[model samples]
Target: MSSTTNYILGVFDDEDEVLHAVSEVKSKGIKIDEVYTPFPIHGLDTAIGHERTRLPIAAFMFGTLGMICALSLISYTMVFDWPMIIGGKDFFALPNWIPVTFEGTVLFTAFGLVITFCISNNLFPGNNVEPLDLRITDDKFVMAINLDKNKLGQDEITKALKSSGAIEVNVK
Candidate 1:
Protein backbone atom coordinates (compact mmCIF):
# COMPACT_ATOMS: atom_id res chain seq x y z
CA MET A 1 0.00 0.00 0.00
CA SER A 2 1.08 3.55 -0.68
CA SER A 3 0.14 6.83 0.94
CA THR A 4 0.45 10.31 -0.46
CA THR A 5 0.65 13.42 1.68
CA ASN A 6 -0.57 16.80 0.44
CA TYR A 7 1.42 19.95 1.11
CA ILE A 8 1.06 23.67 0.41
CA LEU A 9 4.37 25.23 -0.51
CA GLY A 10 4.92 28.98 -0.30
CA VAL A 11 8.04 29.92 -2.21
CA PHE A 12 9.83 33.12 -1.31
CA ASP A 13 12.82 34.78 -2.95
CA ASP A 14 14.19 36.13 0.33
CA GLU A 15 14.86 34.72 3.78
CA ASP A 16 13.39 37.80 5.43
CA GLU A 17 10.14 37.27 3.58
CA VAL A 18 9.94 33.65 4.69
CA LEU A 19 10.64 34.65 8.28
CA HIS A 20 7.83 37.18 8.18
CA ALA A 21 5.56 34.69 6.45
CA VAL A 22 6.06 32.18 9.23
CA SER A 23 4.63 34.64 11.75
CA GLU A 24 1.84 35.68 9.39
CA VAL A 25 0.80 32.11 8.67
CA LYS A 26 0.84 31.15 12.32
CA SER A 27 -1.18 34.22 13.28
CA LYS A 28 -3.85 33.07 10.84
CA GLY A 29 -3.84 29.63 12.62
CA ILE A 30 -2.15 27.74 9.78
CA LYS A 31 0.43 25.28 11.03
CA ILE A 32 3.66 25.23 9.05
CA ASP A 33 5.24 21.84 8.50
CA GLU A 34 8.73 23.17 7.86
CA VAL A 35 10.74 25.95 6.26
CA TYR A 36 13.59 25.23 3.84
CA THR A 37 16.26 27.69 2.77
CA PRO A 38 19.46 27.61 0.78
CA PHE A 39 21.33 28.47 3.96
CA PRO A 40 20.70 28.87 7.64
CA ILE A 41 18.54 31.80 8.68
CA HIS A 42 19.04 33.16 12.18
CA GLY A 43 15.89 33.02 14.33
CA LEU A 44 14.01 30.93 11.76
CA ASP A 45 13.64 28.04 14.20
CA THR A 46 12.24 30.34 16.87
CA ALA A 47 9.93 32.02 14.37
CA ILE A 48 8.63 28.60 13.32
CA GLY A 49 7.94 27.73 17.01
CA HIS A 50 10.43 24.86 17.13
CA GLU A 51 11.80 24.05 20.54
CA ARG A 52 15.55 23.93 21.17
CA THR A 53 17.21 20.64 20.27
CA ARG A 54 18.49 18.21 22.89
CA LEU A 55 21.45 16.98 20.87
CA PRO A 56 23.95 18.56 23.22
CA ILE A 57 22.56 16.53 26.07
CA ALA A 58 22.87 13.41 23.98
CA ALA A 59 26.48 14.25 23.16
CA PHE A 60 27.33 14.73 26.80
CA MET A 61 25.86 11.35 27.67
CA PHE A 62 27.81 9.67 24.92
CA GLY A 63 31.02 11.36 26.00
CA THR A 64 30.53 10.30 29.58
CA LEU A 65 29.89 6.71 28.51
CA GLY A 66 33.05 6.78 26.41
CA MET A 67 35.13 8.14 29.26
CA ILE A 68 33.81 5.45 31.55
CA CYS A 69 34.60 2.73 29.04
CA ALA A 70 38.10 4.05 28.47
CA LEU A 71 38.82 4.35 32.17
CA SER A 72 37.44 0.88 32.82
CA LEU A 73 39.61 -0.67 30.15
CA ILE A 74 42.76 1.08 31.33
CA SER A 75 42.08 0.27 34.97
CA TYR A 76 41.30 -3.36 34.28
CA THR A 77 44.39 -3.91 32.16
CA MET A 78 47.01 -1.91 34.05
CA VAL A 79 45.77 -2.21 37.64
CA PHE A 80 44.24 -5.68 37.70
CA ASP A 81 45.12 -7.83 34.70
CA TRP A 82 48.71 -6.87 33.89
CA PRO A 83 49.80 -4.39 36.58
CA MET A 84 52.22 -2.43 34.44
CA ILE A 85 55.01 -0.32 36.00
CA ILE A 86 56.64 1.85 33.34
CA GLY A 87 58.75 5.01 33.71
CA GLY A 88 58.49 4.74 37.53
CA LYS A 89 54.81 5.78 37.28
CA ASP A 90 51.99 4.14 39.20
CA PHE A 91 50.09 1.27 37.64
CA PHE A 92 47.02 3.49 37.10
CA ALA A 93 48.50 6.93 36.41
CA LEU A 94 45.87 9.55 35.48
CA PRO A 95 48.31 11.68 33.43
CA ASN A 96 49.20 8.86 31.04
CA TRP A 97 45.54 7.95 30.48
CA ILE A 98 44.51 11.46 29.26
CA PRO A 99 45.19 10.93 25.57
CA VAL A 100 43.33 7.66 25.23
CA THR A 101 40.42 8.96 27.35
CA PHE A 102 40.10 12.10 25.26
CA GLU A 103 40.21 10.12 22.02
CA GLY A 104 37.56 7.72 23.24
CA THR A 105 35.27 10.55 24.34
CA VAL A 106 35.60 12.30 21.00
CA LEU A 107 35.14 9.14 18.98
CA PHE A 108 31.97 8.08 20.78
CA THR A 109 30.44 11.56 20.66
CA ALA A 110 31.10 11.92 16.93
CA PHE A 111 29.75 8.51 16.01
CA GLY A 112 26.77 8.77 18.38
CA LEU A 113 25.71 12.18 17.07
CA VAL A 114 26.00 11.06 13.44
CA ILE A 115 23.89 7.97 14.09
CA THR A 116 21.37 9.98 16.08
CA PHE A 117 21.00 12.63 13.38
CA CYS A 118 20.61 10.09 10.58
CA ILE A 119 18.05 8.04 12.48
CA SER A 120 16.12 11.11 13.57
CA ASN A 121 15.90 12.38 10.00
CA ASN A 122 15.05 8.98 8.46
CA LEU A 123 18.12 9.23 6.25
CA PHE A 124 18.91 5.52 6.09
CA PRO A 125 20.50 4.00 2.99
CA GLY A 126 18.07 3.39 0.09
CA ASN A 127 15.42 5.71 1.56
CA ASN A 128 13.77 7.73 -1.20
CA VAL A 129 14.69 11.39 -1.18
CA GLU A 130 11.90 13.94 -1.65
CA PRO A 131 12.51 17.59 -2.39
CA LEU A 132 9.54 19.87 -2.07
CA ASP A 133 11.15 22.48 -4.30
CA LEU A 134 14.48 22.22 -6.04
CA ARG A 135 15.03 25.96 -5.64
CA ILE A 136 15.00 25.48 -1.87
CA THR A 137 18.56 24.19 -2.18
CA ASP A 138 19.64 27.08 -4.37
CA ASP A 139 18.09 30.53 -4.04
CA LYS A 140 14.56 30.17 -2.76
CA PHE A 141 13.10 29.94 0.74
CA VAL A 142 10.11 27.63 1.08
CA MET A 143 7.46 27.29 3.76
CA ALA A 144 5.70 23.94 3.65
CA ILE A 145 2.31 23.43 5.22
CA ASN A 146 0.87 19.93 5.47
CA LEU A 147 -2.72 20.18 4.34
CA ASP A 148 -3.90 17.43 6.65
CA LYS A 149 -2.59 19.28 9.67
CA ASN A 150 -4.13 22.64 8.87
CA LYS A 151 -7.77 23.56 9.26
CA LEU A 152 -7.62 26.47 6.76
CA GLY A 153 -8.66 25.94 3.14
CA GLN A 154 -6.11 26.13 0.33
CA ASP A 155 -7.45 29.48 -0.91
CA GLU A 156 -7.16 31.05 2.52
CA ILE A 157 -3.63 29.74 2.94
CA THR A 158 -2.71 30.97 -0.53
CA LYS A 159 -4.01 34.42 0.33
CA ALA A 160 -2.01 34.40 3.54
CA LEU A 161 1.13 33.45 1.61
CA LYS A 162 0.61 36.24 -0.93
CA SER A 163 0.06 38.83 1.78
CA SER A 164 3.30 37.68 3.44
CA GLY A 165 5.42 38.19 0.30
CA ALA A 166 5.48 34.74 -1.26
CA ILE A 167 6.31 34.93 -4.98
CA GLU A 168 4.69 31.60 -5.76
CA VAL A 169 2.43 29.22 -3.91
CA ASN A 170 2.13 25.60 -5.00
CA VAL A 171 0.26 22.55 -3.76
CA LYS A 172 1.60 19.01 -4.02
Candidate 2:
Protein backbone atom coordinates (compact mmCIF):
# COMPACT_ATOMS: atom_id res chain seq x y z
CA MET A 1 0.00 0.00 0.00
CA SER A 2 1.27 3.46 -0.83
CA SER A 3 1.48 5.36 2.40
CA THR A 4 0.10 8.88 2.42
CA THR A 5 2.16 11.64 3.98
CA ASN A 6 0.84 14.00 6.65
CA TYR A 7 1.61 17.05 4.53
CA ILE A 8 -0.63 15.58 1.84
CA LEU A 9 -3.53 16.99 3.91
CA GLY A 10 -6.90 15.96 2.42
CA VAL A 11 -8.14 14.96 -1.01
CA PHE A 12 -11.70 15.17 -2.28
CA ASP A 13 -12.80 12.67 -4.93
CA ASP A 14 -14.19 14.78 -7.79
CA GLU A 15 -14.23 18.23 -9.31
CA ASP A 16 -17.84 19.06 -8.47
CA GLU A 17 -17.34 17.85 -4.95
CA VAL A 18 -14.18 19.90 -4.63
CA LEU A 19 -16.00 22.97 -5.89
CA HIS A 20 -18.84 22.50 -3.44
CA ALA A 21 -16.40 21.84 -0.62
CA VAL A 22 -14.49 25.00 -1.47
CA SER A 23 -17.72 27.00 -1.32
CA GLU A 24 -18.67 25.39 1.95
CA VAL A 25 -15.23 25.97 3.44
CA LYS A 26 -15.35 29.63 2.49
CA SER A 27 -18.82 29.92 4.02
CA LYS A 28 -17.39 28.52 7.26
CA GLY A 29 -14.63 31.16 7.08
CA ILE A 30 -11.96 28.49 6.75
CA LYS A 31 -9.16 29.70 4.50
CA ILE A 32 -7.85 27.16 2.00
CA ASP A 33 -4.34 27.40 0.71
CA GLU A 34 -5.03 26.02 -2.74
CA VAL A 35 -7.35 23.90 -4.84
CA TYR A 36 -5.96 21.74 -7.62
CA THR A 37 -8.06 20.62 -10.55
CA PRO A 38 -7.46 18.54 -13.66
CA PHE A 39 -9.17 21.14 -15.81
CA PRO A 40 -10.85 24.49 -15.60
CA ILE A 41 -14.10 24.61 -13.64
CA HIS A 42 -16.58 27.43 -14.16
CA GLY A 43 -16.96 29.70 -11.12
CA LEU A 44 -14.16 27.93 -9.29
CA ASP A 45 -12.43 31.18 -8.49
CA THR A 46 -15.52 32.58 -6.84
CA ALA A 47 -16.19 29.30 -5.04
CA ILE A 48 -12.71 29.45 -3.52
CA GLY A 49 -13.08 33.17 -2.82
CA HIS A 50 -9.89 33.99 -4.67
CA GLU A 51 -9.37 37.63 -5.49
CA ARG A 52 -8.42 38.82 -8.95
CA THR A 53 -4.78 38.03 -9.55
CA ARG A 54 -2.23 40.81 -9.22
CA LEU A 55 0.14 39.21 -11.78
CA PRO A 56 -0.86 41.53 -14.58
CA ILE A 57 -0.24 44.54 -12.40
CA ALA A 58 3.17 43.21 -11.37
CA ALA A 59 4.07 42.52 -14.98
CA PHE A 60 2.98 45.99 -16.02
CA MET A 61 5.01 47.60 -13.26
CA PHE A 62 8.09 45.55 -14.07
CA GLY A 63 7.72 46.34 -17.75
CA THR A 64 7.28 50.01 -17.01
CA LEU A 65 10.34 50.04 -14.77
CA GLY A 66 12.34 48.33 -17.49
CA MET A 67 11.16 50.86 -20.06
CA ILE A 68 12.16 53.79 -17.90
CA CYS A 69 15.55 52.30 -17.04
CA ALA A 70 16.32 51.47 -20.63
CA LEU A 71 15.20 54.86 -21.87
CA SER A 72 17.14 56.76 -19.25
CA LEU A 73 20.34 54.77 -19.68
CA ILE A 74 20.32 55.08 -23.46
CA SER A 75 19.28 58.71 -23.40
CA TYR A 76 21.82 59.71 -20.77
CA THR A 77 24.70 57.81 -22.34
CA MET A 78 24.11 59.27 -25.78
CA VAL A 79 23.37 62.81 -24.56
CA PHE A 80 24.52 63.93 -21.13
CA ASP A 81 26.53 61.10 -19.53
CA TRP A 82 29.00 60.53 -22.35
CA PRO A 83 27.82 62.41 -25.39
CA MET A 84 29.41 61.36 -28.67
CA ILE A 85 29.30 63.23 -31.94
CA ILE A 86 28.34 60.95 -34.81
CA GLY A 87 27.98 61.61 -38.59
CA GLY A 88 28.66 65.33 -38.00
CA LYS A 89 25.40 65.57 -36.02
CA ASP A 90 24.77 67.14 -32.59
CA PHE A 91 25.52 64.81 -29.64
CA PHE A 92 22.21 65.64 -27.91
CA ALA A 93 20.09 64.94 -31.00
CA LEU A 94 16.61 63.56 -30.28
CA PRO A 95 15.83 61.62 -33.47
CA ASN A 96 19.00 59.52 -33.30
CA TRP A 97 18.16 58.26 -29.80
CA ILE A 98 14.86 56.74 -30.83
CA PRO A 99 15.95 53.38 -32.26
CA VAL A 100 18.33 52.35 -29.46
CA THR A 101 15.99 53.59 -26.79
CA PHE A 102 13.04 51.73 -28.26
CA GLU A 103 15.03 48.51 -28.67
CA GLY A 104 16.46 48.62 -25.18
CA THR A 105 13.06 49.38 -23.71
CA VAL A 106 11.44 46.46 -25.49
CA LEU A 107 14.24 44.04 -24.60
CA PHE A 108 14.44 45.00 -20.94
CA THR A 109 10.66 45.10 -20.52
CA ALA A 110 10.16 41.64 -22.02
CA PHE A 111 12.96 40.15 -19.91
CA GLY A 112 11.83 41.77 -16.70
CA LEU A 113 8.24 40.58 -17.09
CA VAL A 114 9.30 37.06 -18.10
CA ILE A 115 11.71 36.73 -15.18
CA THR A 116 9.03 37.91 -12.79
CA PHE A 117 6.58 35.40 -14.22
CA CYS A 118 9.02 32.49 -13.90
CA ILE A 119 9.81 33.43 -10.33
CA SER A 120 6.16 33.73 -9.44
CA ASN A 121 5.35 30.29 -10.87
CA ASN A 122 8.30 28.64 -9.06
CA LEU A 123 9.65 27.39 -12.38
CA PHE A 124 13.28 27.61 -11.55
CA PRO A 125 15.92 25.36 -13.12
CA GLY A 126 15.51 22.68 -10.51
CA ASN A 127 12.67 22.57 -8.02
CA ASN A 128 11.04 19.82 -5.99
CA VAL A 129 7.25 19.66 -6.01
CA GLU A 130 4.97 17.89 -3.57
CA PRO A 131 1.91 16.83 -5.52
CA LEU A 132 -1.07 15.73 -3.39
CA ASP A 133 -2.27 13.11 -5.81
CA LEU A 134 -1.77 11.91 -9.39
CA ARG A 135 -5.51 11.70 -10.06
CA ILE A 136 -5.86 15.29 -8.97
CA THR A 137 -3.75 16.22 -11.99
CA ASP A 138 -5.52 13.79 -14.34
CA ASP A 139 -9.17 13.75 -13.30
CA LYS A 140 -9.93 14.32 -9.61
CA PHE A 141 -9.69 17.52 -7.60
CA VAL A 142 -7.53 18.03 -4.53
CA MET A 143 -7.71 20.58 -1.75
CA ALA A 144 -4.64 21.21 0.38
CA ILE A 145 -4.34 23.09 3.62
CA ASN A 146 -1.11 24.15 5.23
CA LEU A 147 -2.17 23.47 8.75
CA ASP A 148 0.06 24.49 11.58
CA LYS A 149 2.36 21.43 11.55
CA ASN A 150 0.47 18.33 12.66
CA LYS A 151 -2.12 20.50 14.32
CA LEU A 152 -4.91 19.63 11.91
CA GLY A 153 -7.87 17.58 13.02
CA GLN A 154 -8.13 15.03 10.24
CA ASP A 155 -11.54 13.81 11.30
CA GLU A 156 -12.97 17.30 11.28
CA ILE A 157 -11.64 18.00 7.79
CA THR A 158 -12.89 14.63 6.58
CA LYS A 159 -16.34 15.33 7.93
CA ALA A 160 -16.36 18.75 6.30
CA LEU A 161 -15.32 17.26 2.97
CA LYS A 162 -18.09 14.63 3.16
CA SER A 163 -20.69 17.15 4.21
CA SER A 164 -19.75 19.31 1.25
CA GLY A 165 -20.51 16.41 -1.15
CA ALA A 166 -17.14 14.81 -1.51
CA ILE A 167 -17.69 11.59 -3.45
CA GLU A 168 -14.79 10.03 -1.61
CA VAL A 169 -12.12 11.35 0.71
CA ASN A 170 -8.52 10.47 1.25
CA VAL A 171 -5.77 11.65 3.54
CA LYS A 172 -3.48 12.20 0.59
Model 2 residue 120 distance off true place after TM-score fit, in angstroms = 3.8
For each candidate, C-alpha RMSD in Å?
Answer: 1.7, 4.6
- The 10 consecutive residues of candidate 1 with the worst lDDT sum are 1-10
Q: Write the per-residue lDDT of candidate 2 for residues 1-172, one digit (tens) a residue.
A: 1234353344666667777778786665556767888888898887777788787777677667766877788778888888788999997777877787667767776787788878978878887675677777786777766443334466666676677776666654
TM-score (all chains, Cα) for each model: 0.95, 0.66
Whole-model lDDT values for every prediction: 0.91, 0.70
Model 1 residue pairs with clashes = none
Put down candidate 1 lDDT per residue, 1-172, tens digits, no spaces.
0138889899999888888889988999999999999999999999998999989999999999999999999999999999978999999798899999999999999999999999988889999886988888999999999988888899999999999999999988
lDDT of 2 at 145: 60
Distance from true location, Cα of 15 in model 1, Å: 0.6
- State model 1's lDDT: 0.91
